[model samples]
Target: MSGAVQAGYAPPTGPDQPTSGRRWVRWLVAATVLWAVLLAVLTWFSIRDDPPTVREQRSLAEAGPVTDRAVGELLAAAGDGGAARLLPDVLRTGCRITPMEDGAALTRGVEVLLPGDDARGLLQRVADRLPASWRAGVETTGDGPVLRADAGEFVAVEGHATGADRVRFTAATGCRPVGDGYRPLAGGGGPETDQATALLRAWGGPAGQVDHVAAACPGGATARTARAESAPAADRPSLADALAAARGGAVGVRATPEVYAWRAAGTSVVAERVDDRIRVTVTTGCDA
Candidate 1:
C-alpha cells in the first residue's frame, strides 16, 4: 500500500461554491435587499411627515436672506380680508426689525376680527405655512404660532379673541409686548391713545399736547415708541439719547423702577433699555 494522505471535502475558495455554500450566499443577498427596502420606506415616511415649516426653511435658505418687503408680503397674504372680516375699526398693523449678530429680525403684527375657536384654527394654518423655524409646542398650541431661529432670534405670532370675536394678531422678533390690549381704531382709540391716557393718569396731570423730540426719527405724538430698525446694532440709539430726549424740555429725569421718566406739557415720556437697544415712550395727555 502506498503511504498517502487523503484530504477531506474542502469548500470552494473562489466564485464557484458547493450547493450548500451557494444557498448561504443567496440567503445573505436576500437579507441585504430586505434591509435596504425597509430603510427606504422609513426615509420616505420621515420626509412625508415633516411639517410644512421645515420645507419652508429649506426653500427660504435656498432663496437667501429675508427682507422687510418679504415680511410685509407675508403679512399681507396672511391678512387676506376675505377669510374673515378685518375689523378696520380695531385693525392695527405694526412692523419692526431688530438687529442681530448675523442679520436683522423683521416682525409684523396684524389684529383681525375672528372668533376665538375659529381664529385658532386659522392661525394654526398660518403657522404651518410660516417660513420661520418654530418651537416644539407651537404645532400644538391653543393660541397661535411661536417661532424661533438662530439666524435672528425668536419670532412669535399669537391670536386672541374674546367672546366678542375680536382678535389681535401680534408677531415679534424681540420680546416687546404687542398690542397691549385690543382697542377700536376709530374715535382715536388705539395703542397710542391708551398709552397716553394711562401715563397722564399716573402723573396726575391735565390733558395737554405731547410732542416727540426732533432727534427721534419716525416720531409722532401718536407713536409711544420708535425704533431705528434700519440702523445697525452699534449705530442704534443709546441710553444717553433716550435720556436726552426725555430731558429736552422743562422736565426732570427721575429713575423709576422700569424706566427713566419726565413730565412736560402735561405729558410723561419714559425711556428704558431693552437688551442692547433703547426704547423711548412718549405719553401725551390725550383723552381716551
Candidate 2:
C-alpha cells in the first residue's frame, strides 16, 4: 500500500443537465418577450399623449366641476360679460395659447385662465376655444338641447316661472377665489330660496298643472341677499389682476358654505307647494 493516498479530482463536466439548462434559458427568453409585448400595450393606453390633463386646478368654493362657475368668476373678476363669453372654453374645450382679439384672448385650444392670464390674446383664445354645447346659454333658447345633468340647481322660487304666462327657472351659484382660480360654484337656485323644500312640497303636480316660473331673485329686490344664495357655476379667472382685485375686494369678494344643506339629501330637484306659493327646490349655492 502506498504511503501517500492519491486524491481523485473530477474533471469539469460542463452542464451535466444541458437540456434542463437550455429549457430554462428558453423559458426566460420567452417570458421576457411576453412581458415586453404586454408592457407595450399597457403603455399605449396609459399614456394617450393627448391633452396633458390640463393641470388647471380651478379654485372653486365647494362644488367639484361645472360651467356657470367659470362664467361667474370670469364675469365677477373681468367685470360683467368678461369671462361670461369664455364659459364653453374654460368649462369644456380647455385652455390654449393664441393670437389677440379686440377684447379677449384668441389663444388656441385654450379654455380658461386665472385673472393673471387675462391678456387680450389669452382671453381671445379662451373665448374662441369653447364647446358649442352649453355655450352662449343655449338653454335659454326656446328650442334647443336641454340637458338634465343634475337639474336640481335650476329650481326657482316665486312659482318657478318667469311670469304668470311664461314659466322658467333661475340659474344661481356661489363661489370663492382659491387655487389659481375659483372653485366651481355650488349648484342651486339659491340657498335662501330653499327651492328644494318648496318643490318637495309641490310633489307630483301632473305636468302643465302650473304654467309659471320665477327665480329665487324675488324681483331682484334682495339683490344682495339673493347674491348670497346662488353660487358661481364654473370657476375660471379671466385676468389675474381681476382675480387679485376680487380677493382684495377690488374685483369681487364672495364667500360661501362648505355644503349647501339641501344638497346633502341627494335630492337634486324636488317638486312641492307651500301654502299659496308654488316652488321647486334645487341644489344651489350661496355667494360667499
State which candidate has the highest TM-score. Answer: 1
The positional error of residue 74 in candidate 1, measured at the CA in angstroms, is: 21
lDDT of 2 by residue, 93-173 (tens): 222322331111111010111223223333333233333332322132354222221212221111012221222222222
Q: lDDT of each structure?
A: 0.37, 0.27
Q: Which regions of candidate 1 are displaced past 4 Å?
A: 1-19, 50-225, 228-258, 261-269, 272-288
The whole-model C-alpha lDDT of candidate 2 against the native structure comes to 0.27
Q: Report how far off residue 258 is in candidate 2 (Å).
A: 26
Lowest-sum lDDT 10-residue window in model 2: 101-110
Best by lDDT: 1
- State the local distance difference test value for candidate 1: 0.37
After best superposition, candidate 1 residue 254: deviation in angstroms? 7.7
Error of 1 at 175 (Å): 19
